[model samples]
Target chain A: MRIVVPAGGTGGARFVRGLLAALAEAGEPADVTVVGNTGDDITLWGLRVCPDLDTVTYTLAGAIDEAKGWGRPDETFTVRDELAGYGVLPTWFGLGDRDLATHLTRTSLLASGATLSEATATIAARWGLPGLGVTLLPMSDSPVETHVLVQHPDDPAGAPPRLVHFQEYWVGLRAAPRALDVVAVGAEQARPAPGVLEAVAAADVVLLPPSNPVVSIGTVLAVPGVRAALEASAAPVVGVAPLVGGAVVRGMADRLLPALGVEVDAGAVALHYGASLLDGWLVDTSDVHAVAPVEQAGIACRAVPLLMTDVPATARIAAEALRLAEAVRA
Target chain B: MRIVVPAGGTGGARFVRGLLAALAEAGEPADVTVVGNTGDDITLWGLRVCPDLDTVTYTLAGAIDEAKGWGRPDETFTVRDELAGYGVLPTWFGLGDRDLATHLTRTSLLASGATLSEATATIAARWGLPGLGVTLLPMSDSPVETHVLVQHPDDPAGAPPRLVHFQEYWVGLRAAPRALDVVAVGAEQARPAPGVLEAVAAADVVLLPPSNPVVSIGTVLAVPGVRAALEASAAPVVGVAPLVGGAVVRGMADRLLPALGVEVDAGAVALHYGASLLDGWLVDTSDVHAVAPVEQAGIACRAVPLLMTDVPATARIAAEALRLAEAVRA
Candidate 1:
């Protein structure tokens, strides 16, 4: 079976790892194509850093720090510390030594006129992504930065909200400030990277892992043609709820969902994607009440354990999502 | 007193350290401006690296590794090793983690439209060079890379020598091949960096450290206005021989001098600069025989122990050079 997954950095990466494990456990070869979110990408220390892309790639390659679900294993912050010593700013977003090599190669290639997808392919290949029967594709080759709008504490009651880069909100501010809005800058101008549309078009099932609905997957869908491609795909589209028990398993989904006027629940998130694009939605067993509310919105819904606590437990969740997709298949 | 020294990386940096010590020992507050050769500067990993300028700044700031005489003390090569793992080339040139910060900062500044001189000044200030009464200047703001022409081992009959970057010859090839010619690319078109000619012209005395004659000092003199400025200066110009006895204390000076058709002796190197440019020359006591030859060439020569065995020994050499400058002051 062919599975195409749209993923983010941390929570989505863990889900995808579980998906890979599930596919491997089937004792049959399966083609998995992961479309990584690039809205969280930023340039630091003169190096173009694609945090989400690297996270998914490293996770699948078995080079990721399993504990953090992002960055490389045995990573060192020697260079980052040195940069701090020189007073280079944004000290909050630390790029470790092993992680620096990826940025250096990507930045070098991009500087030499290679597109983001081309550079991504080269880096992913180094991690043997293709050999593992997984093809990782960037959402878009063009630059797209996610910006978060937040209320300024010092501003007057009627003053306009402050806008900062997504990283500035998440890493720099430690996600403390409330996000009034999340905007994916340049999303409209970006085209789906090479093989992205085709991967979804040819898949048996298009799965949305437990990734952030607003910034991660939402920003990717914000890109022109991506949502249309998914809607038009022959495969059944399935989404595993990022919110398990009315809260995110990881990341700040609760804070972000409210900004878009969506309730922080599995049912609201499913409705956010809507029944037209999502044929099947998977929620946690604890939120079994969300199943009827989601199904009433004209989407097939199922309740399963959604927490990716371990590989086996996560893989079971992925299997349940696929089973739901099969149940909703036309 | 105002003094100007034209210098290269290692030998010149050590000499300057000794010069600072000597001035302090004599209870003198000297405004010392060092004109660092930029010909050996190369772009590594897409970052502009100014080796000579960094050496002088680090040495003056007492941050240089005393053993290596260049780079930060207690430096690590984590990023460099990681780069090599990514199969980045020229693993031969190792940039320590701490040192990488300097290059990253410089590259970022240059990318943001700062000139080489401006970047050098900022970097020097970081090391408290200004408060120490020292100003570091690059020979030219514009790039002037030194390329060495060497014979190809594959060619039986002598064909025109193949030219490689000075770094490729020295670091990459380990300077094993004979240097047939040393050319400073872009030298003629390049103008001296800001305050370079002024530093030399307004000096109380101009000194040449025991740096490479051909590539180091030679490249600096290749800049159009620099030679003219030194000659027109009212201050006496004195040069310390890089060679001791019949050989250099360090570096490949003996092998390179012969390639330029100059004898590998103290007197021959003094004449190579010519009596018009050099008012006085200091040779090691073992090369006492060179005194007459250099004096006969219309230049005053002094024989002293030229080996910089330690900081104190180096200071004594600097004091002797100052005495020789006094004798030629006129």
Candidate 2:
């Protein structure tokens, strides 16, 4: 079976790892194509750093810093220190030395006229992802940066919002600022990267892991043809809530969700994606009471232990999502 | 007094450090502008690497690895290892993590339309070199890489030469292959960087450090107006021999000098520069017998203890070169 997953970064990456494990445990061979969100990509120090893509890639390749759920294992911040030494701005986004090679190769390849998808494939092959039955793809080839509008600190009346790169809000400020708005800068003009549509259309199941719906998967769907592809695909679409009991499992999804005026609840998230696009939704056992609201919205719902504590625990969650997908199909 | 010195990496950097010390010991504060050779500069993995300029910067800043005579002290090779992991070419050139930042900043600044001179000043200020009465300048603002023509390994007759980057010849091949010719690619069209001509023309004295005369000083003089500026200036030009007893102190100067068909003797190197460009030349004490030959070439010559065993010894050599400049001026 071909499984298509539109993912953000850390959370999505963990969920995909679970899905891979579940498939392996079943003794079934499967093809997994992860469409990584590129909205968080930024050009830093002349290097095109795709944070989401690298996070997913590093996690899948077993090179991820397990503690952080992102960046390379045993990563050193020497390069970051050096960049700061030169007074390069936005030093808040710590890029590890090992991780920098990926950006260097990607930037060099991109500068040489390779599209983001092409560069992704080149980097993926190096990680032996193909051998692991995994293909990592960028959501779009065109540049799409997630910029956040935060309430101006000086403006007590909040007349004008200060705009900053999504990274500055998320990583730099730790999402402390009250974000007034979130915008995927170029998503309106972005077309699905090569193979993105085909992967979705050909998949037996399309999964949205516990990624940020507002900025992560939301940015991917914002790309012109992506949402249409999911809607048109005959395959059932399943989503696992990033929020558990009104709080995010990882990252600052809580801060981002309310910016769009969406209630930070499992059922509210499923409804935000809406019944038409999502055939099924998975909520944590703690929010099992909220399953009825999601089911009432015409989407099949499942209550499972959604915390990806380990591969097996995550696999159970993945299995639950797949079971819900089967129920939706029935 | 204004002093200008044209330099390369390693030997040149050491010489410059000694010159700084010599000036300090004499309690004479002088405006010292170093015209760093850019011919050896290479773009690796899409980052503009000014090796000679960085060596001089790092050495003078007290951040250089004394043991290696280049790169930053306590540097990590994580980036280099990672690049090798990605199978990036020319992995032979070891770029330390701390050093990579310099290249990144320079590349970013250059990409943003800052002239190399402007970028150099920015980087120099970060190292506090400007505060220490020194200014680092690139020989030319334009890109000029040294490409070496070597005999193809398979061709015993040496009919067709294989052209590779000077770095590949020096670092990758370890100067094992006979370099048929060394070409400063793009030097002919290159113009001296901003302030280079002014520094040389306005100087009370100009010095050529004990760098590779064939490639280092040669490439700098190859710049369209640099040689003319030095020739037109009333200031005396003094050069210290890179070769000691027909062999170089370090690096592949011995291999490179012979590639140009010039004898690897102190006097021969002085004759190559000629009386028009060089007012004085300093050879090692061991090569005192060759002083008459250099003097006959219409350049004042002196023999001194040229080996830079330590900072003090190197400073003494610098002092000797200054004394020769004074004598030539008289």
Candidate 3:
């Protein structure tokens, strides 16, 4: 079977790891293509940084820091600290010494006129992604950064919200301030990277792996042709809830969800994606009541264990999602 | 007293450290301006790598690895090793992790339209050069790379002698190939970096440190108005011999000197600079035979113990050079 997974950083990377394990245990021959969210991409120290793409690549290569769920293992902060000492700004972003190698290679390639997709391919090749039966591609070659509009801290009395990069909101500010709005700048003009639409069109199964609906998966869908391709695809489209028990398993999903006027509940998120995009939605057993309300919205719903506590436990969640996809297809 | 020094990497950095000591010990209130060689500068992984300027800065800041005579103390090679893993070409240059921060800062500044001189000043400020009563400037603002024309190994029959970057020849190939010529590309059109000529004209004394004459001091002289400024300056110009007993104290001066039809002899080098630029030349005691010949060329010459075993010893060398400058002034 051919599977297409559109993903974000930590949670999405964990889900895909589980998906791979599930496929292997079932003895199913599968090819997986991951469309990484580029909205979280930022240029720091004049080097291009794609947090989601790097997290996924490192996780799959078994080089990720298991404790943090992002960045490389045994990383050093020599470069980051040195940059800080030089008084370079955006001191909040933790750019590790080992992780800087990826940015350096990517930036050099892009500077040499390679597209983001081409540069990503070159980096993924170093991790032997092809040998793992995985192809990782950014959502779009064109730059599309997610910016969050938040109320100015100093002027709480109805001042126009100031825009901050998604990373600045999430990593820098720790998602403290309420997000007034999230904008995927350049999404209207960005074309789906080469092989993205084809992967969606040719897949036997399309998975949205518990990524944030408002930013991660949502940003991917914002690309001009992406949502249209998913709507037109004949394959069963399945989504796992990033939220379980009315809270995000990881990341700032709960803080960001309210900005879209959507409840931080699983059923509300499925409705936000809607029946047009999702044939099947998997919510955690803790949010079992979400199943009925989600099904009422014309999208098939199933309640299962959604927590990615470990690979084995997460594999069960993946199996349940795949089972729901089969039922939706029938 | 105001002092101006033209210098390269390693040996030159060591000399400047001693010069500072010499001034301090003599109770001389001096403003030292170091005109650093920029010919060795290269863009590696799309980041500007300024070896000479960094060596001077790191050495003076006491952050230099004493053993290696260059790079930062306790430097990590994670970035360099990682870049090599990605199969990025030109792996011979060892860009350490801590050192990379300097390059990243410089590259970012230059990309943002800051001149090389301005970027160097910003970096120097971080190293507290101003606090040390030292000012470091690059030879020119315009990009000038030294390219060495060497007999291509594959085409030994001489296919017009291929040109390789100075770093490729010096660092990558270890300067093993015979150099046919050394060209400071862009020197003809290059103007001296701002403040270079002013520093030279205003100096009470100018000393050429024992750096590679062909590529280091020679390249600095190649900048359009620099040689003219040195000749027109009222200050007596003194130089320490990079060669002692017909051997280079450090670096590949022996391998590169033949290209300019100059012998690896201290006297020959002084004659190459000629009487117009050199008012006094300091040769090692072992090269005492060179003294008469250099003096016959109409440049005052002296023999001294030139081995810079440590800071105190190098301070003595600096003291001798200053004494020679005073004699020439009389």
Candidate 4:
């Protein structure tokens, strides 16, 4: 089976890791492609840092910091501490010692005219990733930084345009602001990362794990031809709901979904993705009541226990998604 | 008294620290001006690093690595180790975590067209150092990297040039190659750092600490009009030998002096500076026996124990050099 997984951050990566391992153990070797979102990538300390791409890479290599769910384990912040002494701001967002090499190499390559995909492949080879069982591609090769635009109550139409980079708003601010808009600032100029459109088009199943709808899937869809490829593909397009029991399983999804005028509920999310693009929507068992409401919106809906606690559970979820795709095509 | 010091590296910096402390203790309020060497600057991990200037700053700020006599006392190598993972070759120089910030800021500023001298002043202001009655100045505003030309008998100039950055040749190789040539690559195009000529022109006394004479002093002299200003000054010019007991006190100097066609001795070094440029020269008491040769070369020579073991000893050495310069001026 050729499965395309669109990944964004730690949650998406962890889920993908589980899926890959489970499929292998099930005696069914499948090719998995991760179209990672680089919307949150930022130029920091003169190095290009792609958070989601690195998260997936580290997780796949088994070098990930399990506790933080990102960066390398036992990573030192020797460089960050040194930067702090110079009175550099933004003390948060730990850029650990071991992780710096990744950024440095990526930044160096980008500075030297190589694209992000080329650098990613080189870094991947060093880690000896199991081919991903698959290809891991960025959403876009061109620069695209996600900006969270918050309208402070005191001054509307944007309070001097307080634009925070996605990570700054997502991690540093702990997602505290009343976000008026979450804008992928440079998406219009971004072309799909090489092989992204082809991977989606050629896939038997295109799956969206419980990644942030706005930043993750929304970003992937933002690329000039990515959404069009999904719509035009013969493959079954399925999405596992990020929202469960009217709340995000993790992260600031509850705070962000409202910006799109979408309620923090499974039915609302299914409608938001739209039945035209979504062949099947997987809602949590707790959100089973919303299955019919989603189907009434003209998309196929399934009620499944979506809480992925362990690898077996995730594999079961993956199996269920594949089963649903097969049934829809039949 | 307004004092101007032309210094190069760790040894030179330590001497200045000792001298400053001594001056403070002696109740002699003096305006200290330091003209630092920039020839050892090199690009690493895409950041332009100025080693000598930071050596002086960190030493003066009391954050210098005591044992290493370079980098920060509690320096971390987040960036270096990270860069290494990316297979960045020749990771010989230890750019500490704290040091990376300086380089990041300096490189960013330089990339933005601010001269080295302007950046140095900005860095100094942040260190809360002006109250110490000292001003640090880079000798040149232009980028000047020192390159060592090594000629292995097996390989010669026709074979695509055996060129290495000074740091790699010195620290990386430990200067193992036979001495061939030391060239300050950008010396011919360098302009004096802002206020460098003025400070030298308006000094009460000038001292050259025990830094690499070829790369350091040669680089300072490479700046246009700096040597002319020093010659025109009424203040006596004296140089303290880096050589003690016929050996360089530290680092790869012993191997490099010969490459510049100078013998590694106090007398030859004094003669290399020449009588017209230097009014006096300070040699180690071990080389007190060689003073006659230096004076015979028409430069007044003072023999003293020139090792900077402690703050007081360094101060005493500085005071003696100043006294000799005054006596010679009379």
Candidate 5:
């Protein structure tokens, strides 16, 4: 089946990385299309750093840092130290030596007038992922920076006033401050990345992995015509809850949930995705009580253990989600 | 006393590194100015690779490898290995991880419209140099590549002569093949690097280290006005012989000398530099007999035990060369 996955952060990437492997093991070849979120993209030290896009590329290449779950594995930070020596002010995001090479190569290509999509394709080819039979793509050629509105501890007004870049919030601050809003700053300006709509429409199944709703899948949906394409497609669109219960399985989703005014629970997450576009929603047994509410809202909800302890478990969960999706379509 | 040193390449750099320490110990502060050869300049994989200029910078920065005597000490090659995996071919020259950062910074600066000389100054400011208040300038803003004409051994019918870049000949082939010529391809068009001629003309004494007389020092003289500046300078220009007895100290200088139709001996080398520009010449005790021939050519000749075994010894050598220049001028 043609699967269109709109992934944003590491969580989304980890799931797809397994899904591709699972499909291969099952003797079923999948025509997989990825619409990566560009919202977290920023011009870092002059190189365009698309964290989400790199996550996908690294994961597919088997070069992703399995422990930290971002950047290339076995990387060095000589360039970061050198840049610091040059009196470059920001030293928050540590760019490693090998990683700096990719950023440099990408920046050089972009400087030469190639679109981001084309550059991504060239980079993907370098990773030797062609044999995987998956088409990876960024959501837009235009820049889209994700900015979070957080309540500053120093602010006497108690207002969530400042907008911080995603990397600053996640990597620098470690999401310590209480955030009130997460905005895709250039969402209105960003068009769907090339072939995003076509890939979505052609897909037989659209899977929304356990990525952050606000920043991961949210950023992909924010692009013009992408969400519309998913809604218009005949494929069974299934979403697996990022929030396993009343808490995030990984990452600092709990801290961000309050900022977006979304409840820190799987049921709320399914409801947040809404029933209009979602044909099936997978929830853990802890959130089974919320299934009726989701089904009543037109999404067929299934209660199952959703913690992906291992690759096999994650693939099984995907299969169960697909079955639920088929039931909803029937 | 001011010294004009036209240098670059590992040998030149390593010598200067030792000379800097030696000069400090001898309580002599040289108003040193380095006219770095830019013949090895290349834009590899879109990166401005100034092998010679970087050698001088790193040497002055005290970060050069004493063992390899080329790149940064304790250098890592993660980028080069990663590039290799990505099918980036012709990875002959080993660019260390820390070293690549320097190249990238330089390339980025150049791409942003800064002249090579301006970029060099900014890099120098990052690393504070002591006992060396030297102005480092490239031989030209326009690239001047050195090409090696070698007889192709693999060709069946004595096919047309094949020419390869200097790096390919020196680093890749290790200069084993029979070379027809060593041409400074673009030196004719290359302007004297900014402030080179002024440094040469204004110096009180100029001393050449035991650097590659053909490639390293030859590329500098190839620049448009550098030779003329040396000819007109009131300063006594003296050169230390790279050839100890009949053999080259390091690298394939003996092989290269033949390409220029010069014998690989101290007397032949001094004869090559000739009388008009050279007022002083330093030869080893082994070649003490050739001092008369050099003096007969209208240049002051000195016989010195010229092995740079240690810092003190190297300093003694520098002091001897300068003393000879002062004596000749008097």
Candidate 6:
């Protein structure tokens, strides 16, 4: 099976790990292509940082810090602390010493005229991604960063909103302030990275893992030609709900989803994606009532245990999504 | 007193610490400006690493690793070890975690359009150099790296010599290979950084600390207008010999000096600078015989105990250099 997954950071990484386990257990031979979101990419201390791509790569390589759900195991913060000592700003983002090596390598490659896609391939290869039957590509080679518009803290009343990089909102501000809107700054001008469109078009199945719909999957779809390719793909497109029991399993989806006026409900999220793009949707058993509402919108829907507490439990969820794809094909 | 000193790493930094201490003890209020060599600068992992400038800054700030003669007081190699694990080349250069912070700050500043001089001032301020009555400036704002020509290890018999960055030769190869020649790649066209020439011309006394003459002090002089300024200055130009007992006190000067066809003797080095640029020279008492030859070359020469074994001993040597400068002025 040729599978393509559009991923974000921690949550998407976990979901993909489960999907890999599901395929391996069933004795299925597969080629998985991951189209990672570049909307959260930020240049820190003159180094290009691709948070989502690194998370996916580290998780797959079994080098990730399982407790934090991101970064390398046994990471040190000596560099971060030293940077703070130098009075460099935005010290809130945790850049581990081990994780910094990836940024350094990628940044060095980019400095030498390599495109983002090329640099990502080089870094992913270091983590042995190809050996695991996975190919990871950025959503686009051109820069596209997510910026969040939030009410200015100092001028809360009758003041124009201020724009902050998504990382500042997510990591620095902890997403506390109300988000007025989110914008993918360069997405409109960005073409899909080489092989990204073809991956979606040629896949036996396209999966939308449990990632932030607004900044993760939505940002990937925002790249020109990407949404068109997915819409035109012959394969079934299935999505696993990022929410369980009307609450996000991880990340600040609840804080950001409402910025687009989407309710904090599994059914609302599925409906927001709508039937034209999604052939099937999977919600948690606790939100089984969402199944009926989603299916009524011309999309196949299923409810299963979606906690992802462990690999086994998450693999079961992935298997159910694949089964729903088969049903949609029928 | 207004003083100017041209410096490199380790040895020069140690000499400067003693100068500062000597000035303090004598109740002499002096504005000491250090022109640091930039020929040793290299871009590793896409970050600018200024070994000489950092060494002087860290030593003056009392944050230097005393045991190693450079870098921070307490440093970690997490970043270095991790970079090696990623199979990055040139891992021989030691980039401590705390030291990497300085490079990151500098690289970020330079990327944002700050010149090397401006960046040095900003970094020096953080280390409290200004508070201690010291001003640090790069020899040039423009990039001028020293490349050593050495016989290629693999093709020792016939292939034309290959050029390696000075760091690769000194740190990576331990300067074991015979150096054919040294070139300051961009020095001929480079202009002195702001205040460098002025510091030389306006100084009450000019001191050349015991830095590597070939790559450090010599490279600074190679900058188009710098040598002219030092020669034209009214202040006496005095140098402390890097050699003691006919050998380098530290570093690979012994390996590199012969490449210029100059003998390892203190008198030979003073004559290499010639009487036009240097008004006085200080050699170790063990090489007291060098004084007669150096003086015969129309330069004032002194034989002092030049071993900078500790702050007090180094301070006495610095005091002797200052006394020689005064005598030359008379």
Q: Best-fitting candidate, measured by TM-score?
A: 3
Alpha-carbon local distance difference test for all models: 0.89, 0.89, 0.92, 0.82, 0.81, 0.91
Encode model 3's per-residue lDDT on B1-330: one tens digit a residue: 899999999989999999999999999975999999999999987889999999999999999999998899998899888778898645689899999899989988888899999999999999999999999999999989999999867675847888999999988888988999999999999999999999999999999999999999999999999999999999999999999999987899999899999999999999999999999999999999999999999999999999999999999999999999999999
Candidate 1 stretches with Cα past 4 Å from truth are A152-159, B152-160
Q: Compared with the true structure, what per-residue lDDT tens digits does model 5 show for residues B1-330?
A: 778888867767666666676668768775788788887777665678888888788877878886776788888887777667555334678788777767767876786788888777777777764336767778778788988898756666768888888888888888888789989998888898678888887888787877887888888888888888898999988888888877877778898999899998897898898887788888999988889998998888888988877666777787788788889999
Evaluated with DockQ, which candidate comes out highest?
3
TM-score sort, best first: 3, 6, 1, 2, 4, 5
Tens-digit per-residue lDDT, A188-298, candidate 3: 999999999999999999999998888999999999999989989999999999899999877889999999999999999999999999999999999999999999989
Q: Write the per-residue lDDT of candidate 2 for residues A1-330, one digit (tens) a residue.
A: 889999999999988889999999988786999999999999887789998888888888899999988898888898888788888544788888989889988888888899999999999889888988999999999999999999755558847777889988888778888888899999888899999999998999999999999999999999998999899999999999998887987889889888899988988999999988999998988999889989998998888888888989999988888888888888
Interface root mean square deviation per prediction: 1.7, 1.3, 1.3, 2.2, 2.9, 1.4
The residue-by-residue lDDT of candidate 6 on B259-310, one tens digit each, is: 9999998999999998999999999999999999999999999998999999
DockQ preference between candidates 1 and 3, better one: 3
Per-model chain A TM? 0.96, 0.97, 0.98, 0.94, 0.95, 0.98
Best by lDDT: 3
Model 6 chain B poorest ten-residue lDDT run: B82-91
lDDT (Cα, 0-100) at A224 in candidate 4: 84
| TM values, all candidates | 0.97, 0.97, 0.98, 0.95, 0.88, 0.97
lDDT of 4 by residue, A138-244 (tens): 88889888888765334566347577788878777778777778899999999998888889888988888888898887888887888888888899988889888
RMSD values, in order shown: 1.8, 1.8, 1.3, 2.2, 3.6, 1.5
TM-score of 2: 0.97
Flag regions of model 2 displaced more than 4 Å: A154-159, B154-159
Clashing pairs for predicted structure model 2, backbone only:
none
Q: What's the TM for model 3?
A: 0.98
Error of 1 at A238 (Å): 0.9
